[model samples]
Target: MEEVLREIYCALDQVLRKGAYINIVFSGEFKHRSAVTFVVKGVVENYFSLKYALETLAPRGVKPALKPLLMAAMFMLKHGEIPGYAVVNETVAFAGKKFGSGVKGFVNAVLKKYPTLPEPEGIQKREAELNAPEFIIEALEKDGVDPKTVLRPPASDLVHFRLGRKGKTEDLSGLETLTRSEAGGWFSMPDTRLKELNASGKITFISPSSMECVNAFGDINGKKYLDVCAAPGGKSVYAAEKGAEVTAADLYPHRVKLIEAYADRMGVKLNALQNDALCRRQEWLNAFDCVAVDAPCMGLGVISYRPDVTINKRPGDVETIVPVQKAILSEAAEYVAPGGRLVYSTCSVLKAETEEVIKDFLKKHGDFSIYSYKNNTDFGRLIMPDGKWDGFFICVTEKKK
Candidate 1:
């Protein structure tokens, strides 16, 4: 138990102070301890809630060094199956050894009063219960999204995958399929079986919204396609599967390699290149029938999978990313041949990333116009995260011939 707490503290310190991503830290430090994994993930995922409770309990405010311990202890006490006394005692002892006897006394007093603390009132209560940051709450409300609906912990550990070459759906038997995409080969599966299937090259994981983005491109048979920011290439593979002659490009060589590896494993042919998406390439001007700018943004849509999107991200990040997304979009547009399709997409529901970026681009480029999808509005299609799918936005535009 002590070792588990220590591991949680060390890993969380990297997250809170060092700005390391939680998934990378967890995979490296805490993957071996299944029990500790649940507790640590719960604490980090519900950080604002735990911090709110701790603030009410410890009015002087907890120090950064001790916050992780309190947060983990509070999570265990409120959410874990462990006995309360064990949670309190073990945490207090861990505090004493790490901080000193004085800190231990402070921890003990606050935790002993935890159960009796009054419930937070109104918005704070709502915020704590939802485990949502104020900025996220405000943003969702501004976008007409009900925060309660989207701020949920993922209900299941199911991973979505598409069949690779030489793979059949029957090869992944015994797994329940939650949803199937119009692309025909895509389906969801219990994440428990992902490691074995992923290693065997029978399945390549992709988000359902991403699958939909590829489908939004309509028929790509024999069409020349450019994926401007393709990395860890799921969408590129999907485009190739749809019979597009795909060329995947990213800024860094390492990311380009990921696309190459994915293409190899899927038995698909696609050219991978390392080229900055923001730079204008004269040779690529009007060279492709379709262009996919999966521009990088705040990724608010994927908070359920990557909780750090809320914790590590600042409000300014949205502002910072807008121009970059616009620049990439402008460059990607140059690559689309006349009458060809340019699909601008992001794993973000924020209007700044989706509607605003496209709105701005349309204002500048008279040659392009929005081509609506089935449920799309003038702004674009904003797919909010449900229990099964991550939030996403896709807008397709056609260049005037």
Candidate 2:
């Protein structure tokens, strides 16, 4: 248990000190059979809260090494059911071994005095519980978050499957359900469910929402289609499945490889290549009948799945993504045939990335008209954060002959 705690602390320290993403660094490291799994998960989930707590509690003159131990101990001390004295003693011992022995007493002193720090009302907040960052909270506040609408913990897997019996899509024969939730319209299933479904001859796995966005737009007729920025190629596979010959392009080779791997898994063929989506090569500039541009932007829409992004994302982050979104949209417009449909989409709800970007693109190219969703989707249905689906925005435009 001590070793597990030390590993968690060390990885967390690396994330704080070296600017590593916590999810990438801590993946699979927290798995253990002991009761400490709860403790470890609690610490990781409330890491930001702990940071806030330490900033509020630690003495002004404390050294940086001592701060993490203090942060970890303070988090466990406040949140863990263990008596405060035992937490302090164990953490002091942890600090002596992890840091130098010289810092152990200081760790003890800080833990001893933690009770004196005035607890902020927000200290009780956990990261996993909110499932979003402070900016999202601010955004929700601006949009008016309803207390009644905030999601409660979901039902057990078996219960959700029972509810699914009322619906036609679920096949509830012989299956071991791992998780279930009704947060959104669909009963959210864990990857285990997908595995079970796949075993029963059901499939279609898309990593990013862009693929789903393009698939949601128009019909893919097996004609040659170009997917610009086709990393982890969800759209390419979707198109290929519908008989479209796909040319998936990414600026980086590694990303192209990911696209190829997805194609291989789905038993679909696509020409995956590395190329700058912005470059106007004469051979590529006016090519292809259909083009899909899943442009990158501030990922405000999918924050529910990735809670840590909001902690790092700022208002300025939107600005950095806007110019890029415009560049790709413009470049993709050129590739579409005179009458071919060009899809512009983002897994972002921010206006700067969605409507504003598309609005600006249409202004520059009056030759293209915004394609209305004739029978495909409810084109104007704004899926708010409080809603089932993540915040997503899609626009389809067609080049005029």
Candidate 3:
């Protein structure tokens, strides 16, 4: 148990020091003890507080390499009933194994000094914000959703049933059905239930909203379709089932391979290509009858499933993703043949990433207009992150003849 706890600490330390995504790290270290599991989650949930604490303890000149472990130790000192001496001994031992004896003394000193550290204003604000980063709180404030308290999941999944092409509704009775079948779609379901659902072969274990989004768009009857940035191919397969000739492209080679595998398993024909949509290559330029750009964002809307996002994500994440979103939207616009439609979507509720990005795209591309089908829908209709589905924004645009 102690060794597992040490590994968890080491993993967390590496994640915070390098700013690596914790999801990747957490998934890799899944066999740790339950106490270690709880500690990992607590450290991640309180990452900002942990970062702030490290900044306070370590000298600016010294690299705060063990920030996650230090932060976890501080959390224990401030909140847990663990003896201060034991915390220091264990954390220093962890540092010795990872960073060597050269850094052990520093680690020991910091843990010993953990309880004596001054209370930070950031911690108070975090507590007030229910452990979410201040930036998220600010963003949510703009949306009028006070995120000071936790929210509850809906009694049922976001959609009671998917709308079939002939208007038949396919009912999904269990939460696991949604996750296994549609993993890319984000939703918060219990882990035990998700495992059971996976074991049953109900859904392929992707996102929570996968089924809802695929079904909502209806099926394509083998018509030509383009999925821009479609590396993981969940939507592509769903479209193929409806008989669409799917062309999925992403900038990354690895992602293209992933899509190819998914297409193979789903028994769908897909032309998976490693091409940047932003470059507007002539081969793909204005060549599709339909295009889907699922632009990336800070993912503020799906915090329930990725509880760590609320703690680790910063305000700058939105700013960083905005240019990429705009570029994708701009490139997607050029790919829609005249009179054809291009769909712009994101699993984010932030105005800057969703409606605001769409507004800017419309401003830049004078030849396209809002398709009205998506524009006239209720403001909060499909984007109910606080309820069943994670917050999602979708807009359709048609190129002018």
Candidate 4:
């Protein structure tokens, strides 16, 4: 238990201090230890709530090194299968090793008092209960998302995957099906089974909401297509599989290599290029019959899969990305041939990143207009996290002929 607490301390330090993504940090450091992974994830995912409780109990405040330990201990005491006494004792022992006998007593006293602490009331209570940030709760409320829904963890660890090569879905065993995508080849399966199928090149993991963006493009058989910001190449590979003559581009060479690797594994041919989405190439102007700009954003919609997003993001982060998204969309519009379609998508639900960006872009580009599809809205379709899938906002626009 002490060792797990130590590991959690290190992982939390990286996230809270160094501003690293939790998924990347955990995968690199603690993926081998299932117990450590579970505890660390639980602590980090519910960090805000734990912090609130610890701070409430310790009016003088806890030290930085001690905070992670306390948070982990608090989480274990309340939610984990471990008994409260065990959690308190192990934390004090761990604290003694790191901070001497004096600090150990401090740790013991604080944890012992945690349970008797009065529960927070009203919105503060909701924030602590959900372990979500106040801003997130308020934002969801504005969007009409029940705060209770966003606060609860996802229902399953199932990941969506697109069948890369022709094979029987039944051949993949041990996975429970959640839902099938409207896109013919995609389905959601348990993460373990998805990893197995991905290893054998039988499948590639992609969010179903993302696959819906590709689906919105309709039939692209034999048509020229450009993925303006393609990386780790799920959408590019999907388009290629659908018989589109695809060209995938990203800002960096290493990212383009990911596309190449996916295309190789999937046995599909597509051009992979390293090009900035914001830069216009004269020769490539009006070049493709279909273009997709999956612009990067704060990634609030994927918080279930990547909890680090919440910790790393700031209020101004949306403002920072909105212009970039609009810029990419502008450049993407230039790449579409006359009468061709441009699909703008983001793994974000924030209006600034979604509707506002699209709304602003439409105002600037009078030649283009919104193209509606299933689940359409005035500006675009917003798919919120359904406990089973991540949220995404996808908008399609067509250039005037």
Give the number of the best model, judged by TM-score: 1
- What is the full ranking by TM-score, best candidate first? 1, 4, 3, 2
Candidate 1 has a TM-score of 0.88
lDDT of 3 by residue, 1-401 (tens): 35765776767665566655666666664565555656766776666666656767776734556666677777776666677777777777877877788988888877777667776675454543356666666676776765542222233443322222222113234444343224233343455644444334333444445444444444457567888878677677667767878888888999899898876655557789898877877776777777888776676556555555555565588888888999988988777778777877777767777777877888999998776443434321236564455667777777897
Candidate 4 residue lDDT tens string, 293-362: 9988877777787876676556566668889999999988998999999999888787778898888999
Stretches of candidate 1 off by over 4 Å are: 29-32, 59-61, 98-102, 153-158, 177-179, 186-194, 252-254
TM-scores for all predictions: 0.88, 0.75, 0.78, 0.87
Question: What is the C-alpha lDDT profile of model 2 across 290-372, one tens digit per residue?
Answer: 78877876655654444344445555666788898899889888888777888777776665666778778889999888777
Tell me how far the alpha carbon of residue 373 in candidate 4 is from the true structure, in angstroms, after superposition: 1.9
In model 1, the Cα lDDT at residue 356 comes to 89
Of the candidates numbered 2 and 4, which has the greater lDDT value? Answer: 4
Off by over 4 Å in 4: 29-32, 59-65, 96-103, 150-154, 157-159, 173-179, 186-194, 252-254
Candidate 1 lDDT, 107-174, residue by residue in tens = 99888988787877877777677776777778878988777666764565566677777578677666
Better of 1 and 2 by TM-score: 1
Q: How far is candidate 2 from the true structure (C-alpha RMSD, Å)?
A: 5.8
Give the C-alpha lDDT of model 4: 0.80
Cα deviation at 323, candidate 2, in Å, is: 1.2
Off by over 4 Å in 2: 10-48, 59-74, 81-83, 109-116, 121-188, 191-193, 196-212, 374-381, 386-388
**Which one wins by lDDT: 1 or 4?**
1
Candidate-wise lDDT, in order: 0.82, 0.62, 0.65, 0.80
- 209, model 1: CA deviation in Å? 0.9
Candidate 2 local distance difference test against the native: 0.62
